[model samples]
Structure formats: C-alpha cells, structure tokens
Target: MLAIRLDEPKQFRQIAIPEPERPGPGEALVRTHRMGVCGSDISGYLGHMPFFRYPRIPGHELGVEVLDVGPGVANVKAGDRCSIEPYMNCGTCYPCRKGNSNCCATLEVIGVMVDGGLRERFIVRADKLHPSEKLSFEQLALVETLAIGCHATDRGAPTDGDHALIIGAGPIGLATLEFTRLTGATITVMDMDQGRLDFCRETYGIERTVQFKGDGSELARLEEITGGDLYAVVTDATGNVKSMSNALNYVAPTGSLVYVGITTQEISLPHPLLHRREVSVKGSRNALPADFPRIIDLIERGVIDTDPWITHRTPIDKMIASFDSFTRRETGVIKAMIDVSGVS
Candidate 1:
C-alpha cells in the first residue's frame, strides 16, 4: 500500500508499506476513495498541531467503501460506501457517558493519533462509519469539515433575523457562513484574503465582505455592515491568537462568540469588558454523529455548493508535488481534494 508519511516538519514522503491485515471483530477495512486536505493537516505539516506525530498518515476527512467487515459489524457491510468519522472515543469517560464523545477523556483521532487515509487502505472502528446516500466520494469526504461549522452554529445559537459576523473566509469560515444562513440571519464576513472574501460573495450570496487591515477599524466596518447594532453573534475561524482574543471587541453587548479554530498557546482576553457586556464565549471542537446527516442533506438539497470549494484536484500518484503546491495556497486555493481511487 502506498501512503503519505511525514517523518519531520516540512518533510513528507510517499512510501509503500505492507498491506493491512484483515479487520478485527469490531473494525472494518476501508478502501480510501476521496480525501480532503484540511487546515489542520497544513498545521500538522508545519509542526503546529500538538497531537501530530511523525511517520503517520495525515488525513481524517475521508470517504470510503467497505472492503471487508469483521464479525459483529452489523450496521455496515462490504460494498457499503460511507463517510468516516475519524474520532475514536473511550466510552467510559465522563463526557462520553454524557453523550459528548467529541470531548472524550481518551480520544484517538485517526490520521492524527493513528494511521489514516492518505493511503490505499485504512482500518477504522465500524461504529464511526456513516452510510452515504449517493454522495460523490469528494462530497462525502467533506462531511467532517462541514460538520465542524454545523457544530459551531449550534454553539452560537443564532436566532432568526439576527446579524452574524464570521471572521476569516477559509474553508471552515465559509462552512459557517452557509450553515448560519439557515437561521435567516444577515451575514458579514471579514478576511485578510480578498480572494476568499470574493468567494464568499459570489458563491454563498454574502454581500458584506471586508478586507481585514489588522487595525481598530474592523469593529466599525462590521458595525456599518450590521446597521450599527454590531453583530448579534460572532464566530472566529481564524485560528490566530490575535484575532481570537480581539473577537470580543466586535461582538454585540449581549451577543455570543464562538471560537471554532484551535491554537497551541494560551489566549488572553479582556475580562473586564467581557463581564461588563455580559458576553458569552464558547469553544467548538469536532462534530457529533447528529451533525453528519444534516450536512449531507444540505449538500443533497444543494443548499451548500461543493463545486466552488473544490478548487484543486490531484490523483494519488502525483500527490507529493500536488501536496507541496496545495500547502503554499497556490492560486489562492480554497479546498483541495485527493482522488484516492485514482480518479477525479
């Protein structure tokens, strides 16, 4: 089997390893079909992710087909095409017992803690697979990424007719824009990248786009867009400590702020201002099982368009060179897909 393995920062090699053994009693052998390169993958490549380990395959957003199902695997079987939920949780933990498996005390994320699907084949627990309903491998691979946005929206609890401000126009930010639109809230997006802001306007029907100047004017620009009330809800997907820390400045007095992106260092906040305004701040992690189907239905109903997000495609054989380019944000990339099945 050929897999993408990272031995160190700025180093990735395509190597052939022995094929994986048959699935265990509660596992299934999945043939990788479509894989999406996420921002975390880029961070891992640059040695920013704390959970990343060397000599590991770095892919979690996967769409797969079951090649063989082990004993006791009743929910899915051979020939079933499904989306892989890569989080492996220990059921005995407090959060897991409370049905919040994303915060499990002992969590092993595939492609991060273990081998993942930047390969020809990978094995995962049977329970993590979600059956697909005619979704293309490329579209299904995006379920995990979009689910993060869905989870963020759940945290913010945007009300109908409210104004929402999302900072950063990356893939995750764009996903948040699409899902929050369901609440019928007017949206204003801010990003340093004009190309991404343009994308938000053209593809997602978002007309309020602002170029972030890293100055104090960001708040005023957002206020003007929201008709002087500021945003009723603010979500930061920038993954920058500065942006995340400054998010409270733009949120309305009683508004909610959700941090969907993660960083390694401790973040500072204006405690006095936050307390005075009675603002709520929350953190959003990975998605739960409840989010996957809704994202799929959104895709199926054409509420979210995948064509614009998918700006680059590469076959499995040319992965190394393509991966290098994709990491650089060449051509101001939005999303890049890997054709693990050797077709795109």
Candidate 2:
C-alpha cells in the first residue's frame, strides 16, 4: 500500500506500507477514493498544530467505498460509497456518555492524533461510516467539512430573521455561512481577504460583507448594517486568537458567540463586555455523529451546493509536490481534494 506521511514540519515522503488487515468485528475495510485537506492539516504541515504528531499520515475528511464489512456491521456493506466521521471518540468518556461525543475527553481525530485515510485503504469503525447512494466521491469527501459548520450553527442556534455574522471567509466560515443561510437569518460575512469575501458574495449570493482594514472601521460598518444592533449569532472560524477574542464585540446582547475554530493560545475576553451583554459563549469542536448524515442529506437534495467549494485538487502521486501550494494564500485554495485512488 502506498501512503504519504508528514515526516516532519514541511516535509512529506511517499512510502510503501503493508496493507491493512481485514476488518475486525464492528469495523469495515474501505478503499479511500477521495480525501479533503483541512485547515488543521495545513496547520500540522506548518508545525502550528501543537497536538499534531510528525510522521503522520494526514487525512480525515474521506470519501470511501466499502470493500468488506466485519461481523455485526449493518450500516454499510461492500460497494457502498460513504463519508467517514473521523473523530474516534471513546464511548466511555464523560462527554460521550452525555451524548456529546464530538468533544469526548479521549477523542483521537484521524490524521491528527492517529494515522488517517491518506492511503489507498484503511479500516474504520462501521458505525462511523455515513453511507450515501446519491453523492459522488468528492461530495462525500466534503461532508465532514460541511459538518463542522453545521455543528457550529447548531451551537449558536440562529433563527429565521435573526442577524448572524460569520467572521472569516475560509472554508470553515463558508460552511458556517451555508447552514446559517438555511436558518433564514440575514447573514453578514467579515474577512480580511477581499478575494474570499468576493467569492462569498458572488457564489453564495451574500450581499453584506465587511472587509477588515485593521483600522476599526469594520465595527462601524457592522453596526450600520445591523441598524446599530450587533448580530444575534456570531461564529468565528478564523481559529486565530485575535479574531476569536474580537468576535465578542460583534455579538448582540443576549446573543451567542460560537468559536468554531481552535486556537492554542489563550483567548482573553473582557469581563466587563461579557457581563454587560450577558452573552452566551460556546466552543464548538468536531461535528456530532448525526451531522454527517444530515449534511449528506442536504447535499443530496441540492440544499447545500458543493460545486463552488473545491478550489484545488491533486492526485496521490502529485499530492506531496502540490501540498505546499495549497497552504499558500496566493493560491486561494478553499478546499483541496486528494484523489487517493489514483495511486498506482
């Protein structure tokens, strides 16, 4: 089996490893067809993710074909195409017991904490596969990315006619925007990159966008858009500590602020501002198990468009050579997909 591993920061090597054993009980052996490179993968590649281990096979967002299923695996059978929920949660954890397994205490995200499905084939728990008959491999690979936004909007609980602001125009932020739009909220997107903001406006039909200038003019612009009232739901997908900290300023009184992006640095929130607004602060981790099926259904029904999401792709043979370009801002890579099945 051919695989690409991150030997160290900014270094990837192609290697041949033994093929995985047959699926064990409650698991399924699946051939990887497509894999999406997430921001976390870029962070890991740049040595920015503290939890990321070197010499890792990095891939979590996967579209796969079930090759074989072990005993008791009823969710999917051979030849079924599916999207994988890569958060390997320990069912016994406190959060898992509470039905919040996305943030389970001992959660091991595929590709980050463990070797992931960057190779031709891998074994995943049968329960983690969300089978879809109507989606293509690329769309199936996108389920996990969309699920992140799906879960974030759920956390913020935006409603129809409410004002929601997504602070970031990256893939995660765009995902959040998709779900927030479904809520019937008047959504506004803020980003430093004009190119991304333009894409959101042209592609998503979003009319309200504030381009950050770092001069504090955006605050006035947001206030003007909201008629002096800030947004009812504000989701920050920047994963930058500065942006996360400043997100509180955009939330309306009694509104919710959801941090969909993770930051290693400590985020300082003003106690006075928090007390004044009585804002509800939330940390949205990985998507819930249910999110996969929901996103799949939405995409299947044409509710959420996946056409404009993928901006770059590379076959397995060229992925190592192309990976660096995906991280460069100049390339404008929104969602980069890897064709894992193309490996000879």
Task: List, residue by residue over 209-283, the lDDT tens digit for candidate 1.
Answer: 888898778778887777788878999998888889888988888899999988887788899989988999999
Go through the candidates in order and give each one's C-alpha lDDT. 0.86, 0.93
- TM-score for each predicted model, relative to the true structure: 0.96, 0.98
- lDDT per residue as tens, model 2, 261-338: 888899999989999999999989889998998899899999998999999989999998999999887899999999
State, as a TM-score between 0 and 1, how close model 1 is to the true structure: 0.96
Write down the lDDT that model 1 would get: 0.86
Candidate closest to the true structure, highest lDDT:
2
